[model samples]
Target chain A: MPILEVKNLNVSFKTIDGVVQAVNNVSFNVEHGEVLGIVGESGSGKSQSVLAIMGLLASNATVTGSIKFLGQELVGVNTKALNKVRGNKLSIIFQDPMTSLNPYLTIKSQMTEVLMLHKGMSKHDAVIESIRMLDFVGIPEAKERIGLYPHEFSGGMRQRVMIAMALLCRPELLIADEPTTALDVTVQAQILKILRDLQTEFKMSIILITHDMGVVANACDRVNVMYAGQLMESGSLDNIFYEPQHPYTQALLASIPSLEHEVERLATIPGEPPNLLALPDGCVFQGRCHKVHQECKGGDVVVQDFGAGRFMKCNLMQNLTNGINQGITSNVVVN
Target chain B: MEKLLEIKDLKVYFELKRSLLGKKRIVYAVDNVSFDVYKGETLGIVGESGCGKSTLARSLVGLNDITDGNVVFLGKDNLAKADSKRWHALRQEIQFIFQDPVASLNPRMTVAEIIAEPLNVYYPKMKDEEVLAKVLDMMHLVGLSDNQINRYPQEFSGGQCQRIGIARALVLNPKLIICDESVSALDVSIKAQIINLLKDLQKKLSLTVIFISHDLSVVKHICDRVLVMYLGNIMELATKEVIYKNHHHPYTQALLAAVPSANPKVEKHKHVKPLEGELPSPLHPPQGCVFSTRCPLADDGCKSARPELRYMDDGALVACFKA
Candidate 1:
């Protein structure tokens, strides 16, 4: 079974203005020991979907549908029961290490608290374990630095501490949200390398949420392209990078500047993302999609299933693929 | 290409006043950096955090005091020697666009007022109608609608706020504009839009821009030439092609290699050796080269003597003995 399976997940927030549908009916699966990347622009609801799984939404927000981990339904579960799985079996590393870590607490207390709470480890044993984890994440003199406060460490070092804290229990699944966004390129590279190595050592599945295509390409085994809270495309990293079917995915890939080649002008999807409170009746990306067609204006756009664990939500791609599939079947019959 | 600006041995140091018992210290933020920016070209300055790229940009606009060296503009005006009144006048010809779009803009002010503020300060005697026309024209150039001019920055998204920022920068029709990580805070799609708009405006107005960013790919896309800095020192200065393809300095190579490739196939085949160790504190930088501690090719010679920037066979300037 997959490590995580999210089906038709929707998250909405009630504000003074109206209801803001942050995450649409998003569905995907993370296989065991595989890295799943969720790529999207801001307001695309990539972060919200993961937060929904962790049961960390705001008080005014509402969530529906199923989020199953190891064949167990997580939605609507009591907080006490959910807490047992959270921070132990399933862990998350936040975007900004500076703000996520408590300013008043030292690294030793913050890290040991997790082990003591989850594993019932003694303070002495927890300290030893915390130091070992920190050393594993490449913090120099981990033993001596364990007593330092978060402010004492640099940006990269703080991020490493966050990673070590997240893996304190050796979680089966890890969720890292823009782990390298605030870091410099060289430091980001080092962090990514550590994550890659840790995944191998612990055999843990990871859900990496980011806006950078470069990071997705480098780290993720599979990719899901999100646009305006909807899943535009879901497939292997190679499938998404080399053969993106959805217009939103294609436009996103074309928009990013490549390190290997220089284009005369980057292709941009004109117009801002749709306002959540007043989204269009048709496709979520219809306003900015270059290949938007009349069918897309119709109310419903079904997810098209291409076999071999690939899917896309676009009316235009569905028609094209249907034609190709029919041609392939007819050719097989003739043979 | 004509030389638009010349920076000679620029230095910006911040003194740390310790307690009476402790010795005083100085943070060498921008130490002995010299370069020339050509007219009608986008010069990109790239480095890690605390590498003084922002300090270098702020120094050009008089936002930071120059501890030493000279800033010669247009080969005639010695900006380093300019008084307050002269500096105030020079501000009309040199504008700046800040990094954070939302934070940089005043939330209380409307888009029209924000863009018109520059004109109001520089030409107070001009008619209100003339100011409104210029603001409208600048808004149109930066892709903002005229109807939204009355809306506050809080009503707009990050991308639109950036457009407002660009409009304000262009309202004065400055010869040179300094963008300190202007597009770094934006999303990828929005970043592309801003880049395309900047490139278009650069061509239409023949504007010279100094763009400072940590993203190397974005720098390659928009910049004509790139300057690589490390710990307030210029490690490499060359055209985009040379900097990206034929870089000599070990720091430049490490910086390039650290950028994750957007293409999976290419990334799979590429071998990346990320630079090790964090940037040394500026208060007590290495006695020799600024990057010697983290440089992979560092040896006794590199650790003992500082390398001076010199011209290479390909016309690129490198500051490493091995290079």
Candidate 2:
């Protein structure tokens, strides 16, 4: 069974301008102990979709469709129950660790509170677990550092503290949102390594959300390409990086500046993402897609199973499916 | 070599008076920095935060009064002999494109008025129609439509606001542009678009650009030459090819190693040896290499004497004793 399953999830927010459909019929699942990456731009609704699954959306958010945690419904869960779900079964690590932690609380108190509450451990037991979690996440001098406040640690160290605090309750699934975006490159590597090491040590699933393709390429097992509040594509890392089928994914991959690339010039997607309130009637990426066609418009999304559980959410697949049905080889032009 | 701007022996010091001792401490914001901006090429000045890259850019535009050294522009001594009257006339030749467009642009001014500010100051008696036409033409060139000519800076996204900033800078037909972290605030895809636009405009207008940023990947994409700065001193300056291929400086090598490799199957050095010591206090640097305090290769000679920038193996200049 999948660790987390989300199906037909749509989230909308009531704003002054209009109701913005921030997430549109998003469906995906994470297997036990799998690392799933969600990549998208600033307004792509990748964060909110997961936020909804965690029951963390604000008062103005209107959520639809189903989100299940091990076959348990989560759409209309109560706050008290959701709090139980958090820190014990599910946990989140934000990009900025400073804000996630309380300033007044010492590191020991902040980390132990979750364990004391969820695991029902004694105060002394919680204290031992807090320091152990710190050491597990590679914090130096855990005893001395555990007594220090969150402000005492450096940026990278503080992020490690946040990860330790999140994992202290031994959550089955951890959601990390751009956890390394604020860090320098070398620090980013260290943090990604620690995350990888801990994911294996703790044996938990992770939902990694970030705009950086490079970070996801290094850490993710499977990838979901989100664009304009919808899933543009989903596949393995090799499939997304080496053979991206979606036009948006293609543009994103092509834009990575690497030493291997000869052409100094980059191929950029021409237009900004469609506004959530004013999304196009066709494919979400059709406006910026170079190979957009007339038949790519206004339909319930067409999904073609590529076998072995791989699927493509593209209009070109419709024609390819028909051609294959006629026993003819199907080839689609791609740049 | 026909260089556009040649900075030599540039040193900037901030005098801070202590309250207890009443003693002055000189903060070496920029010290002994020298380089040149060549004609019709992009020179990327890259470094980590607090490396004095921004200070160097502001110093180039005369926004910051230099404590010492020269910012010779087009063969003229910018320090000793650049008369105030000439700065006014030459102001049109050197323009600044800021990183945050929303903050850089005046929100009260319309797009036309913003673009025309340069012309209004430079050409006082020009016809209003001609100024409007120029503003509209610039707007069109930067991909803005005539319909949004009356919009303010706050009405557009960060990318659009940046385009307006570019348009405003280009209104005076400046030969050189100082892009101080221009694309740093933008997204990845937007950054690519802006880089492409800048490259296109650079070629079409035959403009010279000094692009200052800490992002090495972006700098690699946009620059013909790259200069790595540390604590207000040039650690490495070489062509993009040499900087990436035959990298000489130890600091430059460390910086290149810092970028995360996109491939996962290959175990790229997971254990990063980040610069060991904290950035040495810019105030009262050691008598030798600025990096010597953190350098594992620092020797007794390095502590006693400073090394001058000399030609290394690949025609690049380095200051370390080992080099």
Best by TM-score: 1
Best by lDDT: 1
Interface RMSD of each: 0.7, 2.3
Write model 1 residue lDDT over B165-202, tens digit each, in one string: 99999999999999999999898888889999998999
Give the runs in model 1 whose Cα sits over 4 Å from its true position: A319-335
Pick the DockQ winner.
1
Where does model 2 exceed 4 Å of error? A121-128, A135-142, A147-152, A318-335, B14-27, B79-90, B263-307
TM-score of chain A of each: 0.95, 0.93
lDDT of 1 by residue, A132-180 (tens): 9999999999999999999999999999999999999999999999999
Native interface contact recovery, all models: 0.88, 0.40
lDDT string for model 2 (B1-323, tens) is: 58998888998777887858887788888888887788999999887766788988887777777888888888865842456777777778989999887899999999888999999999999999999999999998888899989898888888889999999999999988999999878877777788888888888899999999877888888898999887778888889988888877777877776666555544344555655434566777777787778676778888888777777767777777786
DockQ of 1: 0.85
C-alpha lDDT of all candidate models, in order:
0.91, 0.82
Q: On residues A103-191, what C-alpha lDDT tens digit does candidate 2 reach at each position?
A: 99999988878888898899899999899989887788998889998888878889999999988888899999999888766567678
> Is model 2 an incorrect, acceptable, medium or high docking prediction?
acceptable
